[model samples]
Target chain A: MRVVVPVSGSDPKTRLASVLTPDERRDFTDAMLADVLDALTGAGLEPAVVSTAPVDCDAPVTVDERGLDALVNDLLASTVDEAGGALAIVMADLPLATPESVDRLVSTDGDVVLAPGLGGGTNAFVCRHPDFRVDYHGASIRDHRRIARDAGVDLSEVDSRRLATDIDEPSDLAEVLLHGDGAAADWLADAGFEVALTDGRVAAVRK
Target chain B: MRVVVPVSGSDPKTRLASVLTPDERRDFTDAMLADVLDALTGAGLEPAVVSTAPVDCDAPVTVDERGLDALVNDLLASTVDEAGGALAIVMADLPLATPESVDRLVSTDGDVVLAPGLGGGTNAFVCRHPDFRVDYHGASIRDHRRIARDAGVDLSEVDSRRLATDIDEPSDLAEVLLHGDGAAADWLADAGFEVALTDGRVAAVRK
Candidate 1:
């Protein structure tokens, strides 16, 4: 099975002050995707970064050139078009996103799986069939499950720290900061994120 | 045992936005302090809010016109003077503060107890003796323990939610928001804090 992470540069909740510059955003996103690729490769599955913009990586990096939705559909379609296999569409914002999480999602066949966010939104999605529409936005967990049920695809839900953690908000950043060093951990740490956190820049934004 | 909670106007993190009116700051402080009170109350201790300025509370309130350290010492002296009993000095900030936690700390009354926060800071101190000079600032947990040990006061470490959480930033707000509605919750609900939180205003403060 192949895993494709669709990263959005947008973080609805950004805690670290300018933690990512435009250049850094691309680099950060690429590094996160690389971590995912490394995880997938470690698990014996093909992994790729599918973004609207191209990213340099050891693994294949495909630029959708299209929007996020189009990029998602394109990635899933390419799984069948290229390898004739299923794909898992994951959000790139998750700092804790790990290969183990992706493997678990893509391991099952003929089924759709989802990992819901803390606020009841779908953070990760997996589908066995490419025909499953990628309508994962705004509390899409329920919608994806319904779609899976209607399509008669086997359904499952996973509660995972990796999947649950998508760094989008200030609080999310706190979790990322609190997360003992990992793939995305260094990115924040190297940028003096901890200083801003301890010094209260993050708290100021929160207030 | 008598408990002393010192409320201060000086913020170490400088996270509060200048856009907020004086009323907003007061409300914010009140909401934050209320969370601490709720936790202490939940722990079955009679929580007293000792403020450098007059603080509004449903619980007993004490105004400390002198200074934070002096007020704290006075409160501690009230319980631990030559004739005094056990005293716990709590700081007003932790939103995840729970009463069950304080109970656990006080349960070991014979020992000098210290609850540490992020980076070796003291959140609350329970001392059996009044002669011990309490330093409730800057690595105070380590300082207090050392002081207690030097004074021959049995030292104990109580790792509780009360000791771990102190809302100084936006990240800390998540716990207060996520936890079941408390006094802070009510104040937020009344002041329409949900508008900012739900509308992603809270998310905007991120780095």
Candidate 2:
């Protein structure tokens, strides 16, 4: 199966802007991209980076400046059209993603296999059926399921906590710092991020 | 509207056993119960505690040894049977629930109003329609919606992140430690719990 890792190298991770500067965001995004690439490679599947701009990673990179839906949908359609095989699109911010989880998603038997992120987003997906397309709109997990059902394709969901946990809001950094020892975790540790109890709750912040 | 806060004073929060002792669990449960009581009381409605054991709180306490679903369902059936008025059932672990969120739930016009928990559980609900009952089984939120639809009732959902965040798992303690300032949060803080970056994710622990 061909894997596509969509990374917004240009001004990525704006949600974490409150906690990290623009340079820090770029560094964090690169760390997450490296972690994702390592996981994909460890699974023995060749991954190609689909980015908005050029990114330095140890993978074959493809720069497509189109919108998320258009870029992924076009890639899915053409990948299946030319080779007539399976394709998977994985998000680049899953710092906790593991090789085993990626392998589970790829090996799952379904016309459309989806890995749902928290709050109704698609973290990763494996498309085998010809009519299966990608949609990253609001609540796109539900939207994609409906789309597959309407298209008469079998849909399967990967129940993985590692794949579900993506680095988004600052609070999500807690997951990486606590459960991850990957490139992202190493970067966060070096950046002086620590989990502290702020105002009676757990927050990731630096002194 | 009469509000019923269901609590298992017998052995509450067994899921937190890994992080808290039995006695600590009881204390934490009481603190969360108290926080929920304050939220209910601030909503201008006198609430009652439907508990398995005697609990000290500002509201009236009723000792009901019945099972969770049976007790809440009976309360819903009898409340509508006796007064033909609305009854709301709020969970005892919603330490972050505010007065405005509770008020939003009660004031919402619906035959059945449901507050969905992060998981597939019903956290809080208002039963005004005669046929509306309670179900706390697996995936009860989805089940309740289907029940309300089958009964020809207008079902409204309360979309409050505060109300949805309940203290169940140890990881959930991160939420309380991060966003809560109630008795439960204070209890957790005074107990020396802090959010720590462990194993690449955020977790609550004390050294």
Candidate 3:
């Protein structure tokens, strides 16, 4: 399977602006990308890092300035045609992703296997059958279901908390600090980000 | 309007098990209940704390010893019938709720005004129409919408971050710490619950 880990190199994790500086966001994004790449590699799959701009990471980087939905759709079409097998796309914000989780995605038997995000977004997906295009619109998970049904392709859904918990909003940073010990976690630790009692409530802050 | 603040007194916030002890949970629940009551009272509404077990808070406690859906449904049914006006049910976990937000719920013109939680739950709601009822099952917000449509009553959705922010999981403690200066935030602060970096990731922990 040809796996693509998409990262936002230009400006990433904008939702975390409340808790992270712009540079911190980029660094955190790279750290999460590293974690995803490590998991994909540990699963015995060679993955490529696709980003909007050039990102400094260990993996082979492919910079494509296209919008998320269009870029991934194009990548899937070309890769599946050439490889004639499974092609997977994973979001880079999944700091809690593990080798076993990646293995689950590839091992699931279906034309399309999806790991749905908490807000009904498709976090990671494997497209095995030909003619199954991708769409990341509003409520894309629900849209994916309809697209799969119309295409008459089997769709397998993977319900994993680690995969579902993508680090998007500032509130999500708590999950990584609590449950993860990955490169992203290390980056966050180095950056002095922690869950702290700020003015009497629970919050993630740099302390 | 009779405002009912529903709380799970027996085992509240099971999702926060990783961070809070049982006693801490009880205390935090009471603190949040106090915040909700303060908001309701500030809005000139007589609020009652409805719980499965007896709870000590700022409001009058009404122990029903029933499941959440059953108790809230019963309260809404009886209150709507008796008052011949609007009746509201607000979750006890909304420490960030303000008098302004509660007033928005009561003042909204609709048969049923729902304040949807981040997770598909109804955090706060106003039932004005005679036939309008509530269902707090799994994904109950969507169920309530269907119920309203079936009953042919207009449904108003109040989208407020304060109303949407309900402290459920350990990660949720961050919101209260970040934006809340309420009793719940004070309780969390006193309990030593803070967002901190533990071993690399961000987590809400007692130091």
Candidate 4:
């Protein structure tokens, strides 16, 4: 199985602009990408990064400047045409993703395995069927399910908090601080980010 | 490790009453329970059923007439005081749960491993820490997270569609028909329940 981690090397985590400067976002994104790569490697799978621009990582980086939907669709098409093996796509922002969780996502039997994000996005997925493609639009998880159904493929969903969480908003950082133990968590801690409870909700705040 | 599946044999799946009669609901619930037990046993875990009434199954059934929270808390306390081993609680309605998914739930290392349901419920959980208890109220997953945090235990959440999906509503049966290959799915199929698209949503309707 070939695993791919999609990342935006430039201007990543724009939703976190309120809490992070452009440089900090870029650094944090790299940290998260490193954590995801480590998790995939720990799971005994070699992962390559599909970034929008050049990234400094041990994994082989393929800079695809296209939009997410197009990039993923092209990857799916090429995987079908060339390798004809299973392809697993994991978002780079899921710092909480552990090796065990990644194993669960890949080990399950299905033509297409989807890891739906908390906010109705497709955070990660394993595509084993040639017909299955991705559409990363509004509620992409729902769209993926529909697409799988339309393609007449068996779909399995990996319900994992680790995979479901993508660090886009500032509030999402709290989850990384709380449940994460990888490079991203270390970066946040080094940057003086801590978990705080504001209005009965958890948030990551710099102290 | 001890595995316990709590079931309300008296009045189960009341929310599904609109579609099923009392006897049908009882039978359906039993089928789901059977599937859950099969999954647990398949995962090499001996699971006992803690039910409000007698249930005809291969596993040992402990008739506990207490509420869900009380029964689970009491079980947690006993497991701490006597067994000194981990306790895994899997709800009866998760027909989609396969042995692989169950293995992922129990195999993960954490003091408290939570599998949050689709509708803010804690469907299945493995509790290794003595201080961890369950509260099956509104948004119990959130409460469990908070409780684990307060108890200073290492918390791990398993995001699995198989574990997260509990059949409580009529619409939920579509998932069983689609993804489940267990006794519960067979039961629903035998009952002539088929997946129907209603209002752009998948639903289980009788032919």
Candidate 5:
């Protein structure tokens, strides 16, 4: 099984712009990537980083400038040519992910295993069937299920909070500060970001 | 099609005891139940509450003191006798659930449509196949998948944060106050519980 962690090296986590500067977002993205790599390595999987631009990490980084959908679909197609090989794609923004959750996701038996993110995104997936490909656009989890169904393959899902909680909006930073215990959490804390309540809502605020 | 929201009417939300008193826990449970009921009704489905004890709500309440697995299994069996009928079970503690998410859960096509909760519980499910029974023991979502596979039925999952985020621990209260807009959120505010950062972690603290 080849595990791949896809990241956007440039201008990532734009939704967090209100709280994080561009440089901070880039640094925070690296921190999240490091956390993901640590979890994958902890799960005993040697993962490769596939990013839109150059990134510095412990794992081997492949700078694929293509879009997410194209990059992932191409990776899936190449795996199909390998004849009986599995590919696992995990997004890099899941700061709360632990080794056990990633292990459950990969060890599950199915033609395709999907770990759906919050608000209908495919955070991570394991594709064992050659006919299976990915489409990470517009409710991608639902689309993946339909794609697997159309290909006449059995699909399974790993329902995990750690894998589902991708860092997207500014509001999502609170989850990292609360449940995360990785480099991303350390980065946020070092950057003077902490969870705070303002006007009946909990969010990550800079002091 | 029939919709059921199963709630534990006696000493519910025990995990919340650290922050809420016994009476407060009961009241908070009722508020969460009302939120679930409102979401169901808003989705154009008239739902019934099957509880362990008497409860007050807008929907009809049926007190079934049996365990969760037995109660849900019996409900599935009863639905089998209805001849091509479907049953949807949504947990009462999912205060973040919205009407649109519930609508998607039921409207989706599958023998068993599961909305898995965080930490391996099945928060909500729609069963169209008669042979499918539930076991709400350890890792209920995985058990349900195996059960569906053993029965030779297609299982689909709704990977929704709203349905997945069940209010269990005191930390979960922040989610209700953040993303929730129902009676449960109102109850938390009325009870003087607000989101606060304590010891670098976010939690629902009493003001």
Candidate 6:
């Protein structure tokens, strides 16, 4: 009934140096965490965003007092102690990730449900019980799946495109520009961020 | 066969600000531009990378030494005067953009070939004559298409997936990391740029 979204504001692999100014990158991950919280709250779920990195938010969400991974484990532990039953750990970068997908991921009858990334790594994991401890950093998707198999948890894959996509690179942002239209797109237009997404600029700046 | 690639590097959108580090954004765009140049050169075309915004490059690309719009205009003039033929103005953020697609854009017989973006913006434009100037920026895709219509030049539409996608937001980057592979994918991975591109991190980030 509770979801823990632990965000490590650092993804050295999917950094946004080219498209984002320094300040933009600094605040982006936190905002995304907020958005995920929004999505969860909208879906009538109690959402807790555990920030691995420092962030300030006016949202009614709870920030973990522990490290990101540790906070996630604690959330699971607390959930078990309180008979919370089910817990979901969601990543924040999936812009298209929807609440319906999260519900499906959590509702699946598995001791642990692994929502794998498009690359074969898991993006999210739902644990029915807190007896299993997990290591969720460094190719965490693969690691979690292995753990799920080892624990003999009934594992299910939710092939939701919305839940699968997480933005980290410049080109990935372009895809949202191409398909998404909303406050995010309008904000992009207003921010003069189109240069990185425009084709003319793309062709001109080739190596 | 002088090609004009109008390049612009813009700040990251507020929404994606949370998901990307500044370096990741820069590296993603830089790698995309590099790929665009490689495709152009590999296709045996002379590329004049007109950096619409001021920038430095690691390649022997021509930085539009003048102002962004002016430099594009000058490049257009020079190419028109030299070749006495058509010139192509392509965008730069398309990381997966291919030379074959570029060739297709150029191969079309028309006073202008407009390759529309997914958002109905023009990604690639081929000007058949020197006198017909493209707006080159802003809602120029529609403007260029209208210009082609007025010029009575055969307006050709090449709907290329590679050409259509541009990174305008953080979510867009997620789509790229989800679908893109090969050099751009490898470069993103090697550079430690993680955007979920695959079903997993594209496992869509490192895969």
List-wise, what DockQ does each model earn? 0.05, 0.03, 0.03, 0.13, 0.06, 0.07
Put down candidate 5 lDDT per residue, A1-207, tens digits, no spaces.
889999998999887888889999999999999999999999999999998899999999999999998998888888754656899999999988888788989998999999877655788999988888787765566689899999998898775777988998777887787667899999999999886644323467788
When sorted by DockQ, best at the front, the candidate numbers are 4, 6, 5, 1, 2, 3
How accurate locally is residue A187 in candidate 5, as Cα lDDT from 0 to 100?
96
Best by TM-score: 4
Instruction: Answer with 3 or 6, whichever has the higher DockQ.
Output: 6
Error of 5 at A5 (Å): 0.8
Q: What is the lDDT of residue A73 in candidate 4?
A: 85
Candidate with top DockQ is 4
- Write the number of the candidate with greater lDDT, choosing between 2 and 4: 4
Instruction: State the lDDT at A70 in candidate 2.
Output: 95
Off-target runs (Cα >4 Å) in candidate 1 are: A1-207, B9-14, B189-207
Which is the better candidate, 1 or 5, if ranked by DockQ?
5
Candidate 4 lDDT, tens digit per residue, B56-147?
Answer: 88799999899999999988988964678789999998998889889989998999999977545788999988898888776577789999
What is the total number of backbone clashes in candidate 4? 4
lDDT (CA) per prediction = 0.61, 0.82, 0.78, 0.85, 0.85, 0.60
Rank candidates by TM-score, best first: 4, 5, 2, 3, 1, 6
Candidate 3 local lDDT, A12-107, one digit each (tens): 878788888899888888889888888889899899988889998878998888888899778777877666767899989888788877887789
Each candidate's chain B TM-score?
A: 0.79, 0.96, 0.92, 0.97, 0.96, 0.78
lDDT of 2 at B144: 91
**Whole-structure CA lDDT of model 2:** 0.82
What stretches of model 5 exceed 4 Å from their correct place?
A: A198-201, B1-91, B95-207
Candidate 4 lDDT, A109-202, residue by residue in tens = 9999998765456889999889998888655766899999999999887757678777877767877776678899999999999866553334
The CAPRI quality class of candidate 3 comes to: incorrect
Q: How far off is residue A93 in model 2, in Å? A: 0.2
Model 2 chain A poorest ten-residue lDDT run: A195-204
**All models, RMSD in angstroms:** 9.9, 16.8, 17.3, 7.1, 13.4, 13.6
